[model samples]
Target: MLEARNLYSYYGKSVVLQDLNFDLEPGSMLAVLGRNGVGKTTLLRTIMGLTDRTKGDLFFSGEPLGDRRTDERAMMGIGYVPQGREVVPRFTVAENLKMGTFARKDGKRAIPDKVFDLFPILKEFSERRGGDLSGGQQQQLAIGRALAMNPKMLLLDEPTEGIQPNIVQEIEEVIQTLNVEHGLTIVLVEQNIDFARRACDRFLVMDKGQVVVSGRGEDLNDEIANKHLTF
Candidate 1:
């Protein structure tokens, strides 16, 4: 559903991603794994047009996304949940979710019922301020907010970071459901190798701003992890 060719990304004068290339098929999940400072986050940001500058080709569902503004890309059906879960702190849960629908091409503003099904807590805490929620709750809210956009593809940066183990499992299950049951294309930057192996159809190990090793999920074994991922 998405393709990047010879992708290079920059933040100001410094290049952060170099010659990155990958393809994501419809209804498939790709796990991008690397140690810190290896440009994993930049890959997602570049895809969303959030980087300072980008070079090379980016195509979504066969159409080239050349010089498209961030909002335009959202209208094209890409939802991004950045590393910190950047939910609007002061907004009520419902309001925050509603904000996502602004990017919908159909101009519909209502939150999708599937979002509530994936995250029942969001419905329960609809009236609560986002800033008052616990970390795990906020992460769920972030994902639900992205889902509100009715996206075809989801770019998640470290969705399980800093969460409790139980909530981590919950998020993992949700990711799996989104890919398997709902047929959403997913590009996940994840640190948890176990969850990546369990949830992803394919895995890419990046180092020094490039994809070093990538293959089907079953091929991401101990040797590759020890060589490219071990800290």
Candidate 2:
């Protein structure tokens, strides 16, 4: 449902992504893995129009997304949960989720029943300020905010970064259900190897700003996973 061909991007004067190519099938999960500073997050930023692409093409749902603004991309069904979980610190959980639907073509806000079901913690803490939540709860709130957009393709950057292990497992379970049951297309960038392998269907590894190895998740052998991911 999403494809990047020969993508190249830069931050100020230094190039961070070069000739990167990958694809995500509709309703399938694709994981981008590597140790830090390998362009994993850069790839997602370029795709989302958050970073400028010097060369190459981006296509979503078979339509070219060349030179679109970030908000335009979000309106087109590309929802992103950035690496830091970038939630509004002062906003309540419900208020934060509401912001995601601002670009909906439909006039009314479309809150999916499944989103609340997937992250029941959101309902329990609906009125709590985002900054007051635990790190794991903040992460869930971030993902929940993205889901409120009803995106056709979701781009998640390090969903398990600093959460406790058990909470990471809970997040993983929700990711699996979103893909398997809800048929949400996902392109996940994760540092946690075990969590990525368990939830995604394919893996794309990056090094020095380019994709170095890629294969089915089931075939993500120990050598590559450990070599490319071990810190």
Candidate 3:
């Protein structure tokens, strides 16, 4: 559902992503793996039009995305859960989720039952402030907020990062369900190789802002990890 060719993304004068290339098919999961500062996060940001500028071509569902603004892309059905889980700290759980619906083309303000179903804790704490939640709960809230938009695709940046073990597993299962059962296309920027290998059908490794290795999930073996993914 997403394609990039010779993509270069920049923050002012410094180019953060250089000549990146990838294709994400509909109803499939693609893993983006790389060590710290290799431009994995920037790839997602570029797709969302958060960067200062981008060069080359980016397409979503056969339409050119370079000219589309950030909110326009959201209306086009791309959901982004950035690395920091940037929920409004003052907003209640319900309010935070409602914010996502602002991007919906349908103009519906109702939070999806599917979102509450995936993360039951969100429903339980609907009135709690976002800042009052634990790290795992906040991550859940982040994902739930994105789902509230009823997006066609999800871009997740380290959804498991800093989360406790139990919630990590829960979050992983939710990601699996979203892709396998719900058929939401995913572009995941993840640090966990094992989970990525199991959950993704396609995988790519990047270094220095460019794709260094890419293939089917089975090709993401230890050799490739040691060579391109090790810290």
**Off by more than 4 A, model 1:** none
What TM-score should be assigned to candidate 2? Answer: 0.96
lDDT of 2: 0.87
Better of 1 and 3 by lDDT: 3
Deviation in Å, model 3, residue 65 alpha carbon? 0.9
List the candidates ranked by TM-score, beginning with the highest: 3, 1, 2
Error of 3 at 188 (Å): 0.5
Compute the lDDT of residue 68 as modeled in candidate 3: 93
| TM-score per candidate, chains pooled | 0.98, 0.96, 0.99
Per-residue lDDT tens digits for candidate 1, residues 1-231, read: 999899899999999999878899999999999999999999998889999999899999998886999999999999999999998999999999999999899999999999999999999999999999999999999999999999999999999999988999899999999999999999999998988998899999999899999999888899999999998
Better of 2 and 3 by lDDT: 3
lDDT string, candidate 3, 50-72, tens digits: 99999999999999999899999
- Each candidate's number of clashing pairs is 0, 0, 0
Q: lDDT of all predictions, in order shown?
A: 0.94, 0.87, 0.94
